[model samples]
Target: MSLPKPVMRGLLAKRLRFHLPIAFGLAITTALVFKYTVTEPRKKAYADFYKQYDAVKEFNAMREAGVFESVRPSGE
Candidate 1:
């Protein structure tokens, strides 16, 4: 049985008042979980990788392999 109209009941505001907090809570929880599981580990992996990374050594290796344009090939 249908009861009343919005003029009598104010159903929209009541529904939103109840559901909005729940929706916001769920969104925040999902974001936090995703950050911990995905973003945090990705940041940690990048930090660990960069911690052991050596740029000058890589450049020297590339120079030895004649990978740079400024380093001409031996056949040329």
Candidate 2:
């Protein structure tokens, strides 16, 4: 025996309302997992690179190249 039309529609609506949010939540959780897993190592590598970089050496090299004159102010 077939369900009445209104009953069928009600079942469909309830099923969609229940499952849609679950599906959406799972999709968001999965995307977050993949994003953090893929990017964490790259972020750590960048942090290490910056930690080792010598800003003073880079500044002196630029000065030697005449990119800047004396470190003293031009107003001096």
Candidate 3:
């Protein structure tokens, strides 16, 4: 026998309620991916450059030379 009309409606409503947010979230995520695809390569290159910069001792020396103050540690 078919489900009662109310039961069928309730099931449909419950399914949509659970799935609508997931559908919207996926759509938004897809749009963001497309939008960022163009920028991602440049961002990756900049990140790689920064990683290399952070690895070099000369970068640390330059950063240290510009430091305006040093905080002395009190007795721990």
Candidate 4:
């Protein structure tokens, strides 16, 4: 037996309604997984670098070596 046009339309609408959210949720989950996988290593590397790096020590060493003295402004 053939379904009426209205019945087919209703069925199509119901199917779309049921599957749309699942598709949306899967897309979001996949994007988040890829994002974290790509960024986690970079973030960890930055954290590790910062943990061992000290700006003050580097600045003081540069100053003691007269690196900044030549570049210093006369007014300063």
Candidate 5:
């Protein structure tokens, strides 16, 4: 048996008010969380690793170019 039109409409309206905000809030919260949690950390880590790698490369170059050879200790 089908619900009467007014009853169906009222039921639908009630359900929408209850569920819609929850769904929309969850979607927005998820998006913000993903951006801050996943994207920001990954970007920071990449930048940090890049900087560290560059520093290491520069250090190696300096060592090879005799800039810090005196500090290298003769035993190695």
Candidate 6:
């Protein structure tokens, strides 16, 4: 059994009128929530971690930990 063409069209129009706005609203809300929850926190974490970054100290630490095969140059 199938609905008549006019009834089917009316039902489709009704669904579009109601559900389309709801779906669009939910998508926008979800995107905003994800940005706040994930993107903002990740950016803050990276900024904090790099705020005190030291290059020479890290290099020395890696060298001490046998990460390098070549000896350090006799400049220092």
For residues 1-76, write the lDDT of model 6, one tens digit per residue. Answer: 9966665647888889999999999999999999999999999999999999998989888877778778663343
Best by TM-score: 1
Q: For candidate 6, what is the TM-score?
A: 0.72
Q: What are the TM-scores, per candidate, against the unseen true structure?
A: 0.73, 0.49, 0.40, 0.49, 0.51, 0.72
Clashes of each: 0, 0, 0, 0, 0, 0
Q: List the residue pairs that clash in candidate 2.
A: none
lDDT of 2 at 19: 100
- Please, what are the lDDT tens digits per residue for candidate 5 over residues 13-71? 89999999999999999999999999999999999888758776687777766788465
Cα RMSD, model 6: 3.9
Per-residue alpha-carbon lDDT of candidate 1 for residues 1-76, written as tens digits (9 for 90 to 100): 9976547468789889999999999999999999999999999999999999999888878877889989764566
TM-score of 3: 0.40
Error of 4 at 11 (Å): 5.2
In terms of lDDT, the best-performing candidate is 1
lDDT of each: 0.90, 0.82, 0.73, 0.83, 0.83, 0.87
Single out the weakest 10-residue window by summed lDDT for candidate 2.
Answer: 67-76
Q: Candidate 4: what lDDT? A: 0.83
At residue 51, give the lDDT of candidate 3.
78
lDDT of 6: 0.87
Clashes of 2: 0
Deviation from native of the Cα of residue 5 in model 5, angstroms:
11
Model 6, position 55, has a per-residue lDDT of 86
